[model samples]
Structures are given as C-alpha cells and as structure tokens.
Target: MATEDDGVHTICPYCGVGCGLKLKPGEEDGDVSLQPWFDAPVNEGALCIKGGASPQVVNHEDRLTEPLIGDGDGEFRTATWDEALTLIVDELERLAETYGPGATGFFASSKVMNEENYLLQKLARRYGTNNVDNCTRMCHASTVYTLRQSLGAGAMTNSMADLEEHGEVFWVQGANPAEQHVIAHSNYFREATRDGATLIQVDPHANKTTRDADIHLQLEPGTDIPLLNVVLKTIINEELYDETFIEERTTGFDHLEATLEGFDMEEAAERCGVPLADIQEAARIYAEADNAAIFTGMGMSQHTCGVDNVQNEVNLALLTGNLGRPGTGVNPLRGQNNVQGTCDVGAMPNVLPGYLEVDDDEARESVEEVWGFDIPPEPGLTNVEVSNAIGDAIHGLYVMGENPVMSEPDALEVENRLNDLEFLVVQDIFMTETAEFADVVLPATSWAERGGTVTNTDRRVQRMRKVTDVPGNTRHDLEILCEVGTRLFGDGFDFDGPEDVFEELRDVCPIYHGMTYESIGYEGIQWPCYEEGDEGDQYLYQETFDTDDGLGVIRGVRHQDPKEVPDDEFPLVLTTARLEEHYNTGTMSTRSPTLRRKTPENFVDIHPADAEKRGIEDEDYVTLRSRRGEIVLEAHVTEDIKEGVVWTTPHFSDARANTLTNDVLDPLAKIPEYKAAAAEVEPV
Candidate 1:
C-alpha cells in the first residue's frame, strides 16, 4: 500500500553538488523513500544516480546497531553504552597523561555535517592538541593552501547560480565534473554549454566531461604544472593579459615575468604530452573571454608539487583579471559534500574555528576566551604524518566516519600500522573496514536520521532535516561527541541537540555568526554573512582581494615529475580517479543494491597496446603491481587512456588503487600523490 507522503527536505550526501532532496517516510519506521524536491535550491529536484539510491543504506543489513569493545585479541564483544564510553574515555585520558596531547590524533570526517566537525576540532583543541584533519588532506589540501595564500579564501570564488548565468567560458582542468559531481554538471555546466558557454576540458584521460568539451586537451598525468605554465606563457607572449587589472589589483607580476623569462613553451608542451598550439589556443580563448571560470580537481593536486600546480591556476585567473565578478574565478570542484565546510570550520591541524591560525596568539586567545580553556598554540601532524608516526609518536587514533584503511595511500602499510596502535576508537553508522580494528566502536546515526548544517562547494550553507527515526540503538554523532567532551573535560560539552551546538558554533565561527536555523531557510545562505541583517555574497573579491595586501598574488611555477617515475621493471604510469557510480572507499555506495549492480567491483582502464603486450584481453583478470603492493582485478582494453598511462579508481575495498598510490606528500600542503604512480600489469 502507498504510505502517506510526509516530505522532509535535506541535502544529498553523495557529492559536493549539494542537490536538495525531499524524503518521505513509509508506513514503517526507518523506511524512507526519496522524492524530487521541486523548487528546492541547488539542483532543482533533479537527482543523480548516486543520490537516488542513497536511501537504500538507511536500513542496510550492515548497519552498526550497538556499541562494541574489542577483546585483548582482535575479536570484539558487544557491550553496553556505559561500558564502551568508559573504555574510550579512560583510554583517551591515559594516552594524554602518558604521552601528552602529541601522542593522540583525531580525524574528522567530510561525510559529516559542519556542526559535527566543528565540535570534533573544538574537543581536540580543548583537550590540548591541534593534530586534527580530514580527507581533504588527501584531495584538495594543496588547493586550499594555494587559495588561502593567494586569494584569502580557500573555497570556490563564485556560486553555481552566478557561474551559470554570467559565465562566457568554462576552462576546466584536471577535473571530471560530469562523472564525479554529477548534479553540478547536469544542471549548471551542461546547461551552460547548451546556452553558448565554451567548455574547455584538460585532463590526462578522457571521461564524461570530455563529451561536452569544445576543446579536449588530454595531457599526460602528473604534468599539470607544465601544461598550465605553457598556457600562462602564451597569454604573456601574445599580450592577452588585462594590463590595467594586473597593475592595479595584483602583486608579484614581475616575479612571474622573471620566472617565465626565456621559458621554452614548445619544450614544456612536449614534456606534458600536449600540443603546443592547442594549449596556446585554449589560453587565448580563456584570456579573451569576458567571463571565464577555472575548475580544478585531484589531478592538479595529490602531488609533491600540488601547491605549485594550483598556484599556476591562481596565476591564470589573476593575470587575466577574470576574478572579482559573478562568473570568473578559480573554483576547485570539491569531492565530498562537506569537505569545504570541514576546512572552513577549521578541522585541520593548522587552523582553529573560523580559519584562525593556531599559532596566532590573538586568534588562539579569542577562541580560548570563548571555550574557557587554553588551546595548544603550535600546529601538529597531518593525517599522513600521524600515520607515519603511528607507532613512535601517536599511540592512539580516533576516527569518525572515515575509513582511512582504504582511503589513505599505501593501504597495506596503513593497515599494518593500524593493527599496532595501542588504542583506537571509531564513531560511524556502519561497520567500516577501519571500525573492525577499533578498540571501542560508537554507533552513530545516519544522515537520514539527523538534522544539521553542511556547507557545499560554492560556500552555500544549507540545512538538512532528519528524514526518519534512528535505526536500532544508535545515537546521534553530535550526542556521541558531546558525551565524550562532557565526560572527559566536564564543562562546555552539554548540548540539548544540533540547534544548541550550532548556536555555540556560530558564537566562535565568524563566517557563520549571523546564520541560524530560521535564517538559513530553505534556499540557504552563502557565507561571509558576518552580521544578522547582512545578505551573503554571491561572489567574493569584488573590489579587493582578502590577501594581506588586498591584492591578488601572481607567481609562476615550474613543472615537477611524480615522486615515483616509471622504470623498466614498472613500465606503466598508474593514475587514480573516482567513478560516477561509486563514492570514495565505497563505504556507503557499495552497500546499495542499485550501485552494486551497476559497477560491482574495481576495474583498470588500459591502452589496447599495453594490454596486448601483457597478453591481457578485455575483461581478463590482471594483477596490477607497484613498488609497494599489488591487487588483482579485471582489465578493460581500450584507447580511452593514453598508451603509457593506466587509470583506475579508489572506491573498491577488496582491490583499492591506493595500494599502489605513492605516499610522498606535497611538502607544504601534506597531500599525498594519489594521482600518479609507477606500476605494471600481469595477467592473473
């Protein structure tokens, strides 16, 4: 029988597109069905495949229902909430007392809401440490570092509405929005292209985004800096730059010019495996357009020179003076739903709430005054640093909604390190691969069972309503964090619900200070809403940039090779990206029957020539090996990928691409080189 439709509105938790969703409860409890939320903001009722199948996991068979405590061995025994909470609190206190705050690491999750991440970071700082970070460190940490250094804000400079309405050209590089951010592509980008906006795509391998591209520049992987530098050179040589804007609104022009002095554009083009003429033309179109937007992704990040790679995009936007407007800016298409908010609320190692630097005495003091506790001033280790220091410095690990065992690079080593940790605690809704190793597992409510706020890729802060009742005995994530904070620290952690916690978050987070449940309404409000009556901005940096000098920073960057280059033994370059049907680590997506049937397991895309040489036919099971480890999976012989490069994704648990991904991080951003590696294929 058809149940009465009691529609509850929320945001799609799949991608950063933040498509609005309307959920209806069935006759039974926890039976939620997805309905198109017509006139709801963002995607306008259109849902992607991933978003449509999201409700399947709300009542999945694998849901974590109760608290669990690990025995002396690897086995686990079900325990009451009291027993589990006590063990976790005791272990955390003991670790801090014995090895100090430096011995513990806290990982916030991008999958969670802004309110939850804020509280987690606050708890970490209140407990006396800044050693906290999220999955952004693996994807867009470099983009954030570069954007913060150059433009004063690490998020997208333009909103999707403005980009669709005013954008004349879309210059996309290293990102596959059509495949990854499906809703964003379908509604905004694909619509914009049909209406006359030019689509210029630059990627190592052709994918969904390439189908709509007016210009597809398929350059080699790990060579983003070189390709972008060539575009910069063409703009400078042809005098295509906006001289007035460069002179008045930007700094460091001379440094850029000096770096590009006598630069050989032809040689750089050859090095990146892209035609020089195509790169130059793409540059000319972008520079000449009235409003051109740049969208970058993990292909530009996840390298030793990830910072430099993104800095060049900044250089492109600044030199051409395409920023400070409705549609023109460098927009990093974020991978996860709340990754942007995770950084904005200062869940990382370096920043406090509101992107305030931990080392800054004034910033630290301001936050301390509100929290009633003195925070650690020095910044601590990143996620990778914590992993590398697992046995030596970090004795305990706290994970929330993140499966680092499958998410982090060098997965085999990460698993071994996780096994040796003294104490491990995980708070999530499902029995994740990482949760199996936890000493104390705290079951938390799913997104459909909670209400909170999450900031999307375009800096739009929207509200998500609880669509159903909590499954089994699971508690809310906010409640779990609150209990831990109250039991351990004894003050500041007492919160009635999500609204109460959000009120406290607004008190310290300046960007969110003006927003409340009533204010955030259905349409949602873009941030930089500093005061109650102030309407949020549609685009940032209109008159002056947020840089210290109030001018856009312009600098040139040189190309750098991947840390692990292909050798005779490993003769193919292995690069990783996400698939349309799967989210990262396949934690929630794989559990859905529709998504599972669509793409059941991992597969590698290889050039026909390479597969032929390896005696591998289409759909043949192959062993893909790198310097670190190997995994067996089916191979598809195709020319979609370049001859020397092999492409796969990081979604499957049984066979993850991260097993072969190099862990050499970008020195400044601490992001791993998950995009490129050296590997070989053998028929299994």
Candidate 2:
C-alpha cells in the first residue's frame, strides 16, 4: 500500500472464488475502487456486487471507533482503551475465580483474519478451558464432520480451476450460488453448461442457480435424506454405481446398501415430494458423468440433520468414484472469508489449533511442547450448549468479533442465558445485537485495517494487506486478544505481530507447514502444500487418505427424520438463507448504502398457492411461529418457492429468522434445525 504504487493487488473478500483484485486506494481518506486483474487465474476481471463493494465496507460510517461499556443502568457509554481492557480482564478473572474455567466460554469470529482467529483460539486454550467455538459451529461444522468421516480431510477435494477442465455433470444441491456465491456459480455453471454438462439441482425452492439446471428436484423441506437415499438406491438398482471404486477406494458400502434395502425409490419419492422419474433421472445423470461434482451450501449444513445430508452427498460421490479427481468431489461453499482458515487453525472448542482433537493425548502433547502448558484432555461443550449452561454454572463469556444474538439459533434463549452470566466481554467492530448484551464491548479494527493470511473455501490461502490506519481507539483483534491474555497469564505470552503468531500456528498445524507470507506472497498457497519445493495439487486423497489405515473411511450413515416435522398446527416448512445483498447478520452489508439500497429490508417468500390458501397477499404482514419463538415479516408471493413451504433471508435485524429457528441440534455435529423448521405462517 505505498503511496507511489499505481494499484494494490489483493484478493476478493467475498465468497470462495478468491478472485484477485487490483485495488486503487482512496485518494484522501475515504475512497475505494475495484480495478479488475485480468491475469488472475481464479476470477478473471469479474466480480459480484459483493466483491466490488467490499472496500467500501471498510470505510463505512458505522465502523466502531471507541470501546463502549454498558453502565450498570442499561446504557452503553464511551470508555478509554485502558478502561475497557482493564474492566474486561477484572470481570473475567473474577468469574474464573468464582466459577471454574469451564463455566466461561468464548466465541471467535469467522470474518476475522486468520492471524486474529488463531490468537483468539490460543487465548481460550491458555485460559485452561475448551469452551471456545466460532460461527463455523453453526454453519459448516456438519460439512467438516461428515467429510472427515467419509473422506480423509474436511476440505474441497478439487480446486475451482478443475471446474473448467473436467466436469460432465454438476449436481448442486442445497446451494444457490447465483445469489450468495455469484462468481463461483458463473464459472462452474456457465462453463459446464457450455460444454453440455448435465446440471441437477435439488432444493425446496427454485433458486437463482436453478435457472441453468437441466433437472430440478423441488423436494419437500427436511426430506433431503430420503431423496438422497432414493438416488443411491437408483444408482445401485440400475447398475449405475462404480463397483470397482466402491470395492477398492471405500468401505461401509455394505452397511449403506443394507440400509437402503428397505427404502425403495417410490417410498423416497413419496417422502421428498418428487416424482420417481425425476429422482431416477437425477441418479442416472450423476452416475453417467465421467467426472461430476456435488456443490452444497448452508441449505444442507444448517439443519438438525445437516451432518447426514453431507454424509449422503459424500457417499454418492464415493460410490461413483467421482472423488480425488479434477472437478469431481463434494464442495461446501463457505460463507465468510476465513471460515476455512478459522477451522484450519482449530478455533473450535473440542479441537486444539489445527483441528487436532483436544482429547487426543498425542496431539495434546505436541501443542503442549509448543505452548509449554498441559492441554485439556476432555472435549468441551458446543456453542448452543455453552450458552444454555451459562446461568447455572457458566459465569463469564468472552466473545470476539461475533454477534450471536441475531445469528445463533433460539435467540430468546441465548439472550436469557447471556443476561444471566456474571461477566460478559465482547470484542467487535460494532456494538452489535450480541454486544448490546455484553458488560464490556471492546472496539476492534475491520478486515481492511489488518494484515494477515486467510484460507478460502477451496483451502487457498491469500495475503490480506492493511490498507488504512485503524480509526480512533480501535485496535486489531489479535492485539486485543494478546493484551488480555498477557494480563491474565503474565509476560510469557509474547509475539511481535501477525507473522509471529502465524509462524507458531504453522508449526503446530502440519497442514500449513509450507505456508508463509513471504513464500505465499500476494496469492497465498493452498494447504497440504507441504513447502516451496513440493508440488501443490488441485485434488486431495488421490492415492491414499490421512486416516488410521491411510484409506478413505466411508461411514454407514443412517437416515434420521427431522426432529420437527410439519403438522396440523404448523403445516409449512420454513427454510432460512442469506441474500445476495447482505452477508451474515447484516452487520457489514446493511452499512453499505449500495448493498442496503438493493435489499432495504427482509421479506419472507411464500408460494402463491400457499399465500392464497392462507388468505394472504403479497406484502401482507404475517407472523411465522415455531416451538422456539415467532417473527413478523412481510410476505413475498412467488412461484420460486414450492407449496407448503416458505423462504426467508436470515441477514436482517427486523426479521431475525434465528428467533423462530429451533435449537434442537444434530446428535453428532450439533448443528441446529435451520434448514427445515416446522412453522405456521398466519396473516395479521
């Protein structure tokens, strides 16, 4: 970011495409432009509305400048940096003394840079507790869990570049890339369609991405497992499955086959509300492809059965021998910039940094040698469990760069639990919904105000350069976490900056052994990269896996019905998602006039037939209710949504969908029932 330099080369802050950008810094104090870099390999001179407006978000007026402490009287007043930090430390220390370390919990931000996220997780571990989780727990934890169960690792098996070379069929389910991940959809859908590749889409609603689909299975919500099982049965019955691949490359097919013996195509068709012909067509299309890919979104991973949805997708891929090849694998498009990086850094509670399970003695010893502390051997509570346990025994909560009030499931329950905590500290760029519940809110810098490396959805690491000076008393999240940690644990916690933190992170996390700012340069290298001299492949697990036997372990996943199903009282299935205009929680996108203007408010999309049946018209104010809670939103009558179901974006404050979302979680992954919550909509 030199003054004399013509343009700054950087990566797009939005989506997994990780498009390279030529940024022209603001002339005075507030200006930004997207000068496309045509030579970039990922996205060549093209960006969605998000990528074009990313820089503008950095200089938004709503950016927090100074720390704010909630005066015991319920009002937040401005405070000095020293005052805020001291107050937070004193309260947290008091909480740790009164209650055990397990009583306190921490939640990291997915949008935070990799270095900052690494520090936040480290601070939690050093505090002698594993009650630390991130946005990934709610979003893609199931995807990671299922993939790791089936494949060797929890990442995209192929690179985006592979979409151009080898893709005969693209089965995109539960993902609508046209709105959220626009650039990725453009590259894969456009290229695959041009080459006459078959495109099969499975979703409750006919989303923007479904426009290019050759076959669209508009199935009933929460029936993903039944539909997927039908496809697998079709693959086996029609002799479309790859017998050789299933025999050599995978295990657990016998159990899966036995489970499918009872579930025939007709039963699945009845359950999923799709025609038998359509299900069979989709199965044939997928099985016939020489090279195929499965691209899923939050639609699959945000449900109580989120893990099972992803596990089925993987089973299909493995059965066809579509994995470990170019453009043929399961790709769960991540929402945030560093969600992959945050997970790779092991920011989750149950795992040490680098995804090494905390309970593993060998892994704990490795991290212990580096940090010189005996790591915890027990697995900690997940996010929802942590908040639920707050009032009873949990006394303190240290949240960094996360707004769980509007984001987490069962908002009312979360608010109640958070209010019961004795001490609560929040570090964020804004006084968000979650921060409003905090005793102390520490001001932190945004992405543009920091320099570090972030891993994208495809596991591609890229450098994030600091372009502007942090405003007022605000500081980077890494510096804040380090300061608080030093105060609590003494001077042993020493690090120069993000680079030093990254060096230690790489040393502990073997997947990132070869990555560094110097070696990666502007375009960060992909993980499992080994080092400079070693080669980086577009695909993983070509020959063997990183498991006990060095082979891919396919789990025999049993299909379980959703905890909540549509009944006489709640006859409609409600699905939650993000819009093209707003990112998660509307903290960033709502601040931008351009993006905000496009989506001024949130509205629920109901099928015209359903609306008419309920005597509701477009724009009619209605209350959508579930067992958790209820929310009032205007109705959007459209055919895009299937009958007996409704759709709404979860990025607005006025219509916080999480309020009505059930907190019942998957037994394995612990993800909430976000994809399909049985709720009835009534016109006011």
TM-score of 2: 0.97
Q: Which stretches of candidate 1 lie over 4 Å from their true place?
A: 1-5
Best by TM-score: 1
True-vs-predicted CA distance for residue 372, candidate 1, Å: 0.6
TM-score of 1: 0.99
State the lDDT of candidate 2 residue by residue for 1-684, as single tens digits: 222176666777666667777777676543566687776556777888878788877777777888888965468999998888899888777777877678888888778878888887777777878888888888888998988767867888887778657888888888888887787778767777878888888988887878888889999887888888888888988889888888887888887888887776787798888999988888988898899999888888988788888989988998889988887989888888778888888788778776788999999899889888776788777788888788886778888878889888889888887778787888888778888888888888876677788888888888777666777788888889888889888954578988988898888887887777777775567778666544456788888766667655555455567788889989988888888777888887777788888888888999999999899999999988888888888899999988888888888887789888888888888888788888888997
Best by lDDT: 1
The TM-score values for the models, in the order shown, are: 0.99, 0.97
lDDT of 1 at 504: 84
